[model samples]
Target: MTETLLPTATGGEARSAAWTALRRVRGHVALTLLVLTVGTVIGLVGPWLLGRIVDLVIDGRTDELLPVVLGLIGVAIGQAIGQTVGTAMVAHVGQTVIAGVREKAIRQVLRVSEGRIERAGSGDVMSRVSGDVETVNEAVSGVLPTLLDAALTIVLTAVTLAILDWRFALAGLAAVPFQVVATRWYLRNAVPVIRAERVAEGSRAQQLLDSINGANTVRALRLESDHLAKVTAASDKARQLSIRMAAVQRRFFGKLNYGEFVGLALILVVGFYLVRGDLVTIGAASAAALYFHRLFDQFNVVLGTFDTAQSATAAFARLIGVAEMATPDLRDGGETDSRSGRGTDGSVSLRDVRFSYGADQHTVIDGVDLDVQDGEHVAVVGTSGAGKTTLVKLVAGLLPPEQGQIVLGGHDLAAGASGSGHRCVLVSQEVHVFADTVLGNLRLSGEHTSETQARSALDAVGASGWLSTLPDGLDTVLGRGGHSLTPTQSQQLALARLVLADPPIAILDEATADAGSAGAKTLEAAAEKAIAGRTAFIVAHRLTQAARADRVILLEDGRIVESGTHDELVDANGSRYAQLWAAWSTHR
Candidate 1:
């Protein structure tokens, strides 16, 4: 599986993703533009009315002035109303956009290959889901409005200013050059910096989680200070990058303030001079000055919008990265038929199978041929780092072998031929108990499983001991502050789910290894009983489990070095299986 190639500059890809996200929220775009247009009309009408008031005052007419003033106030109120409605509409759009982004990110993570997830660092995935998605919220809430408001403000201000006086309008246009140049410089540099900073922050979060998860190891090894130093260093790098970006913003703001002051001063001096020289009327001068001030205000809003847009773009890129990393190879309609034993005839075969983690990596499984007949029991034995787990994964169809074919029921595993529930399933050493009831957790794998069926499965796995003790029995919650089951109980719960699923083929890798000998015996007997009429592969650590296998295979360094019935292999005095049996016996 190819993992996410982060830390590689993917600017072009990010831009494309951002545009796609924008397209997804087209409804919001339309509403924002409509509201902005109305708001701008109201805003422009108010200034024009003030200009008319000046015209009236110069004519020495005081009658009906109160009516005109009230008309202006009415226009102001209309502008306020338009802005309020527009803001509310935009806020709704922002929320919808964020929800879409979050869902897409989740789908991406789920679609990615299991091997990629393992190599990509669990911490990074967690960071992307929790932290990277939040960065995009700014784009939704702040960036969109900044964009619409800026565009409408600029358009209306420019038209009003030009109508008042083309010469002063030209001066108003001059500020654009400074604003454009400063903003361009800041954004061009800051986008990459901001993205890098976000990535670094994610790394830091991963490091912190690692420290917490490995707290026992650190304490035993006396490495507390060492781990802390690593976290501190990463955090410091993130802070420095943030400060540097802030400095860029400060410089940009400094230039904007200077440009605004210069534009305002020029308009005031030039307007008064021209009016006094009789080049224009005082009414015209007042109108032009008002237009000039409004232009500056609108221009500032526009620039602010562009800055937010840039930040949003950066956030969009990160979210896209998460999506791309987790893109699934196959799509399932998520339909299920739990009634009539969908994969009951499960039979799997691997021909010349060879597999690796990635390009040019050491092979995890090398050139092995195996067949699992329907309703047969097999045990796989190996030392640490043997490809036993990898082999089982191949049978379960979780990872497609790089060099060979894994066929299930005469059809390639890639075809997903076993129908709704998988033909083969693997239960591993690490068991997860989600925040759900005992029955909820079991029924998650099978849609139509009744409460009685789930309870039966739990009882089959010998998990009824603690489960029956619960207040709600089958309805009892299992995670967090709920039941707080031990590791052995958790493993049994996972097994219970499998029994509920009742896949034709099952692979159990150390399913009961951590549960002690009693748990192991219970699991072995349960497996023999539960898998009575189904194909099963067990990666056995205990010799007793291996001895009971109808057939046994010994793996070493990614290759099958020995295979036969357990008694037959044990009779071969110097064989790999013989040595394993001897070691297991000594330990017992």
Candidate 2:
């Protein structure tokens, strides 16, 4: 069990995340608010003019109709202009906020621990990157504007309605409590359902992506129907959850509509009785009626705005969850030797090392001690279920032992300097051919390598032959789901990179397994040449590579069963290495 920690960045809670995101475009936000205020003023003017027109008509001021009508038209035109500017301003602000969010999310992804990324799965990351972030775009843009407008409209309309007739205004607001209660009921039931729908949707997308990436395996095993069944079940669950969400929203809005109708009827009845009693003039009644519609219209907008806010809150929560991921303990400024160090001494040591997958898990490398001196090549052979890979990972700095320490060239690999040992390279049978050029891949070790250095590195690994045959030579693109190199050729290319990386210490964990005996022999010879005068540890698969080691280590369970030269181990008649060699000889 290799003790792995997640990659994360320095961060606080989701609340902090929202604040951090907002601070990115505070200036733009201020501008947007200013524009929205102007728009609100313009929007209110149109209704005010209508009310004034009614007042004029009722007062028998027929002479004032044309000017009043013209004034109303001018207000309408100004409202339209203001609305356009406000919308554009808000949109620009939203885009800037969205851009900031996208950049931050990507930065977070990069800062998170490598171990966490592996555990989280690619699908979740993809969902966050594409789907989850998309939800926030609408939240950032439309929700804020609508909420502002709703708040202002509610305030202005309530004031105007009260001026018309306090009795009628109070009557108009009577249905608000009913709408509020209904909305609360809907939200209480709907929030869980909406959240469930989002989770199910994410899971379905993840599983579908997994299936697509492994389509060859599914088809080979004739499990297409089984895969489809699993996906269909997830999709059905998502659909059911969505249906529940839709049902709740419909019921919530339906109740809102009912409240609107009830409120309007009350207004009409109350206005008519007030008119009969001569308590309010006809013009005030007509103006009040118009004001009633405006009040309710803005009330609906306010309610809808709240609904959007709820949805945005959920999305913000998810984004904040991502932002809250722990940061890695990378080396601080002035704490690390420059990455430019050209260390050539490969003395590697692990003292009293211990590691476990979890707190409750059994220790894999229990108090293990290992050392490889400069120019010494060692082979660690282990039976199945033994902690071979775990031990190798500890030595390679891919994982830190729970207890004890690893030292390369007397430098302790601490939290900040954990991957500082990247100068100590590890090549495993599981090769990752990145979507890049051959030269690009090699240059990952040292980005400033010249073409001469790259060509020399390729030639040293016997990969120069196939590499030269490529259409673009070292510039040929590879591993983009289109271009490909054979497993053997890819393994050779990996070795070529190791040659270029030129680490003082190298850990080869079955690096040539994909290449078979002949190809392994070629790679083994190349590795010997490249690793000369540097400390190396080979987790050998083929007996030939082990036979070439300066020493061989036999491990069983979590203990070193034997340690001696390969020739010495072979001569020990019934030794594990002797038996392993015999088996390999027979297979060959």
Candidate 3:
């Protein structure tokens, strides 16, 4: 299968996401800006007072010097207090915006179709959810306060310089040309560098996870060295990209440093000539120079964070790209008022159903028609590539039929994008064990399910044996760092979850295939109990499973070759079902 990634969002989309989030919390925006303004005003007072002392010292006014020096101390204290409060307020606002964007991104990820996710590789999807969100969060909470503060300081300081002498302000303008040129260059080049760095990091993480997860296989096949080499190559690539990204950032700073050199020299030159002409008082010239000098630090703060800011912007765009993914419906099954999917007879019908992989690929499921009444237990049996799994997926509303529609409980089963309009669960051989407590994982099916109810469900699914052996019973954690379970136990745990979820429709696609022969029988019995009252479909490779079904359908190359009760199919001596039974039974 080819892996196709979700493209990062365009600049317009990132800006739009920001604008939307800000609009929702305008109250926070107003309070934060007001506090920032007050803090910047306090910052302006320090430079002016320092200039006053310089002038006072020239005139030898020791009587007034003490008060002015004391006042400078007061300004320093006020600026410190204001800055502390301002940082807190701005950080609060930044977190709020991030929370909003993160919420939208998660919602859209939830809505994405299985097909889109398969096409976008598991690692890429995981990267968007975890890595991109983390990058945006660090940039926002960490960089937002300083960046905004520096920007405001630069703008206000220039205004103060103009108040003292416009030539000082014009002197500042001389630096703007260099700064503008540097800024354009940095933005033009830095974005791709940072974006590439992030992508490399995602790839590295994916390679590491794949290698570690398949360690046993790697060792068994003597491919440990090969896997290690792949991991090393991925890590090395990420490291190189990161270094290159830093080089670009350093070059930006180098250019900005040149602008600072030019601006400071021009300001001093302007001040010297202005003093000679006496267009401004000696005290005022000092004040303007002091103000311009203060700008150097603030300017650095803004420029130093430009790369981080660009990274944040790119990360935000990636997150919003996730939010932008639409949940495609298999068909037009409008919203159903009944999430329980009750009130109608629990029946399903597939008419002339056809499905294929890509446009040019041979059909995986040719045109077919079938129906099963509510509470009916039907078994679909076939060899590999017989379209049994595809049929179950269509019935469970996981895949859409290419040529026809599926009707469930008198409503079209569209598997509505958000998983609304129908209540169903599809259990396959692969079961995901979340990094949580056994109870916590089970509660994901129904949050309000009581502990007593959870225990009963576990017992019903024949997990009581291991459940009792667990250190904490249902409360025991069962993920990566927790107690491990065998494949059989894992399937049992899944069956228990199905009992807890208790959806109106339950589909099992080789759910017991992972178990050993003895474990398979146990799981099959447990599965029967779990899906007792629900409309169910089981795709089986085992003939015993088909023999026990209320009705059996034998599929060959994506078409139903035989359909009947177990005994009826067995009675037909030369039939396909009979041939399969003879072959399977002969093996036993």
**Predicted model with the maximum TM-score:** 3
Q: Per-residue alpha-carbon lDDT of model 3 for 1-588, expressed as tens digits?
A: 213676678899879878888888888888888887888888798888887887788778767889888888887888788778888887787788878777877766655655566556667778777888887778767788888888889999989998888889999888888888998998898887888877877677777878888899999999999999999998998899888888888898999988888988998898889989978657777888788878877888888888888878878888887787655442323333353323335578888898887678889888778988878888898788899988887776666677887877667665454333345678998998988888898887778878898889889999888889999988899989998988888888898888887666788889988888999889999998988888888887577888888899888888888899989999987888888889999996
Runs off by more than 4 Å, candidate 1: 1-29, 44-85, 163-168, 265-294, 305-308, 325-328, 331-345, 352-364, 397-403, 410-423, 446-469, 472-475, 500-504, 525-533, 582-588
Worst 10 residues of 1 by lDDT: 327-336
Over all chains combined, what TM-score does candidate 2 have? 0.74
Q: Which ten residues in a row have the lowest lDDT in candidate 3?
A: 330-339
Worst 10-residue lDDT window, candidate 2: 1-10
Instruction: List per-prediction Cα lDDT, in the order shown.
Output: 0.75, 0.74, 0.80
Any residue pairs clashing in model 1, and if so which?
A: 108-326
Q: Which predicted model would earn the best lDDT? A: 3
Candidate 1 per-residue lDDT over residues 512-567, each given as its tens digit: 78877777777777666666667889998677877887899889988988989988
Each prediction's total of clashing residue pairs, residues at least 3 apart in sequence or on different chains, is 1, 10, 0
Better of 1 and 3 by TM-score: 3
In model 3, residue pairs whose N, Cα or C atoms come closer than 3 Å (at least 3 residues apart or on different chains), thus clashing, are none
RMSD of each: 4.3, 5.6, 3.7
* Alpha-carbon shift of residue 276 in model 3 (angstroms): 3.5
Q: Please identify model 3 stretches exceeding 4 Å from their true place.
A: 1-3, 200-244, 277-279, 328-345, 351-363, 400-404, 410-421, 452-456, 459-476, 481-489, 516-522, 586-588
